[model samples]
Target: MRAGTSPNSSSCSAWRSEAGPGVRCSCPRPRGGSANSISTTDVPVLPNAGDYTIGVSIGTPPQPLLLNLDTGSDLVWTQCQPCLSCFNQRFPLYDPSQSSTYSPLACSSKLCRALPLSACHAQCLYLYGYGDNSIAIGTLASEAFTFGSSNNVTVPNLGFGCGFLNGGLFNNESGIAGFGRGSLSLISQLGVGKFSYCFISYDDDDSKSSTLMLGSAADLNGSATAVRSTPFVLNPSQPTFYYLSLDGITVGTTRLPIPKSAFVLQRNGTGGVIIDSGTAITQLTTVAYKLVRSAFLSQVKPPVANATAEVFDLCFSLPSSPSAKVDVPKLIFHFEGADMDLPHENYMYQDSTVGLMCLAMFDSGDESSTIGNFQQQNMHVVYDLDNQKLSFAPARCDQL
Candidate 1:
């Protein structure tokens, strides 16, 4: 999950106020099965909140593991034995020696070719970067990764990164487990055709408790608001990206027309309005950025200056008034034949630094409008890989 409120009790109320409404869904849970019978539940649906934990395993015995979940990247690496230097977290590092199933892919392997042995070597030797400059690096190997309660499983020769050193805000975590669409990614290797991940945040006090689901739709508890699957453009040699034809953005009853150039379509492996569970804040282009920021700031009280150089255009001071409120005009994303309407809170939050500075929920520095964990707090996001479509539904994200 994104960083929490600063270590100050004064701003506690502000944080809770900014949480908006929680999300809850009623999707069915998964049932265990064999490799051939591996249904949705057998697929790994790693969590992207709290200390950045997800499930993984090492060796033929398949010891359960929980590592950070990252979508920007496509590789699912884990810590291995003989880790000279590695960061500490809740889970134990994978000891390759103990795992009879562990095997390193040769330099000639297709996975190595796609990532380029050179890049793989760098990742193995250096640090992996995360939001807020968090970094970690580890080795790569093949192992059994189990999912669901009974642990119906799939054993693939996956790339595991054992992060030894870290800096900035990620010191509290262990290592990263990438969920991107690259050949090195766990999903690609597992042969789980298409799957979707839904994030449901716990109470503001327990942001770390937010849950993530994979493969099946068991964890999601919302009506299926399906939309046409837009073709996800794969960067050939690079990882895959989800792409959608964004016709326009709407706020309330007003539709803001942004030039196609204003938004980058299918640049990264991600396409359409790419949703990144890793980023702390949402990101939008200049045109959509200005429009959304202006509308929010106009309705709220006096404006606050941008906090960091990468801060959004508008921010609200949370502690000043009787909970400042603004009508967040629904921002609608127009796809090919369907228009998805997003709740105002999806892009509005109370600034942690400033007591009452409610701002347009996302930052402006990222290349695309990444729908981060904060925006995904109480929503069910569907990724239809086979059909090449995506869907969304409102939810109440609360602890069970």
Candidate 2:
């Protein structure tokens, strides 16, 4: 599901916002599934807010709530009952009192120690601040989380944040369902050690939902198309972010003169490229972005004009009669061990009302870069934490 918000939200900073219980519970094995895998279908939600959201069922008597499927954060949280002050949410608030499985953590728990300057009282209370300045303050609890599967397999006593006060650019969604690499992340807690997802086109109005697979079934190597694999780097300082070694970028057959060192991981663990699902547009280093933009503009010479839209930097205005031919070049990201040849639809976004198409990428002021979700559409991407590798293969996500 797609939620609407500002297009520039792709720059949303990385990292989990709050701390929660490190508790984990075993989920029932899925039916007709492999001995080691469990798969969940994620519903795609499109609000006027422009953010990608999914419906998650939590509690003993399932209470459905919409949340952002974020890879950059680590804690799965939702606004709960007895909200002292909460943002306006579209979905119903989760009430722990109504569920027999809901269990709030104690202040002295080790999970609370994981949080920065966490405070304890009768119940374990936590505070999370997001990159966009959004804040959620509430209790850390564990409960049964039911994924959308044919058998409705449920993961009991899963740790999560129950927000009593939330404020930020949530776009009315309940909260965030983090899939980061931290111990409290969905993948880490479930002990899946691997996960994968494929996003459909953002313009696909008919896209009902997508699938996020956990365990062996998440592997994309089974595809007929050869899956390109790349080394996945891990930094202890920033455990939540997934770092990739991007050597350079190519427009069609031409490889731009981007220095390999520009993509190198810095000692601080901040200077490198990361694949993030929360961001909507790909962000490149200032040097890399300029080269890519210049090369693309030279190849596709549309009318010399600025984008009327605030979010995009490069845009093209078409003639009175829409032009059938828009020469968008292929974007291939040269990683350390693999190259991802992206489709045109991944790099270009069209505003039909204005007859304008913009490069759905941006320039990052710092050395760090982000490969946004838009560029990953219709592609099956696998994250194998156990093997410390990332792989991908092109596929029609909707049909998959």
Candidate 3:
């Protein structure tokens, strides 16, 4: 979910750059020690579900919640008690009154001023709308947030939203644990040097798990997995996002002729490529995406089908026989310093409704493009904020 919800439903696009968190381009370095490492409860790809969820214990007595790991947006919040318009969640709503340490932030507080659209009554209140028009309106407050199940790490005065009027892309997961480059994001608050996560491909399997490591424990040098690193480019206007430099893309071995300027970040901070965890599929600028599509259509023999699938633009019919197979071309994403050669499974997904093989990427229609989670399967991505670089290693992540 690049990931409070689906790829089509994102809060990042809805975010106004002027209202974003004041973040430094230099980045924050981590203090020593394992801040926390959470073993997530996986709810793999289901009929209409395929987003990552991590557990957190919020408030005094510790109301356990499963939150989406969203690096795309800022603000870590959960649905609180007396939810005036809450969505259906699996766990009980958090009651701030029951917690001994819960307190609402004052309207005059610095935290309240960090947001773009905020109104202060007696308490700091906010109304966040996503690009898909999803809304979460609630009061801003500080509470104790326990990080892990085993080696528990508690941050006693964490700033978060107490969502009372939440709607849109939100599903069963309580709320978003924001890891964006914003002052109010959990990553910014914890002052962690880095964070790392490896996602297994989404499937129907229920018992699978993955680990999210924060602070000093997020070191990539300690892992046996071979890795590559790419420098992180900044979007000053939209400091909440982690931007990347994409050189071009390769279909099989042939690198598509895409100008580097096509992926460049405008000085005003508008157009660029960002590797998002919340988006289910990758989205490339329309022009660049068309080139890739054209190359595939030219090489592949199967005729394109206008499949019943709603989201995907490229879907093709397979041979009638069960044993028949088609050679789906592999896609290699050329980042500034590293190349990610994804397997066939990573780029192509089967639409069970129509039995059509569909391309897992999208055409953004504008300059902004996103590298979604579908292509990141089995890749252990490390957001090394301390060094201002993104690194990855192909690993068997399901064991995490």
TM-score of each: 0.73, 0.86, 0.86
The C-alpha stretches of model 2 lying farther than 4 A from their native spots are 1-50, 221-224
Question: Across residues 8-41, which tens digit of lDDT does each residue of candidate 2 receive?
Answer: 1111110001101110112233232221334543
Reference-based lDDT, each prediction? 0.51, 0.73, 0.73
Which sections of candidate 1 miss by over 4 Å? 1-35, 40-52, 117-136, 150-159, 162-171, 202-221, 224-238, 264-273, 302-313, 319-326, 351-354, 360-367, 397-400
Specify the highest-lDDT model's number: 3
How much is the lDDT of residue 261 in candidate 1?
59
- Indicate the worst ten consecutive residues by lDDT in candidate 3: 16-25
Off by over 4 Å in 3: 1-48, 221-225
- What shift in Å separates residue 68 of candidate 2 from its native position after superposition? 1.1
- Residue 141, model 2: lDDT of 83
The better candidate by TM-score, 1 or 2, is 2
- What is the Cα-based lDDT of residue 334 in candidate 1? 67
Residue-level lDDT tens digits of model 3 in 1-400: 2222221211121111111221111111111122333222111211115567666667665665667787888888888877888887755677788788799999998879987689989899998766558788999999877665334555678899999999988667778778899988888887778888888768735444566777766656436546888999988799889899999999966899998888999998888999877777888998899999888877767788885654788788876766777888879888988988888888888755566888888888899999888788887889999899999988767654
Q: Please report how far candidate 3 places residue 141 from its true position, in Å.
A: 0.4
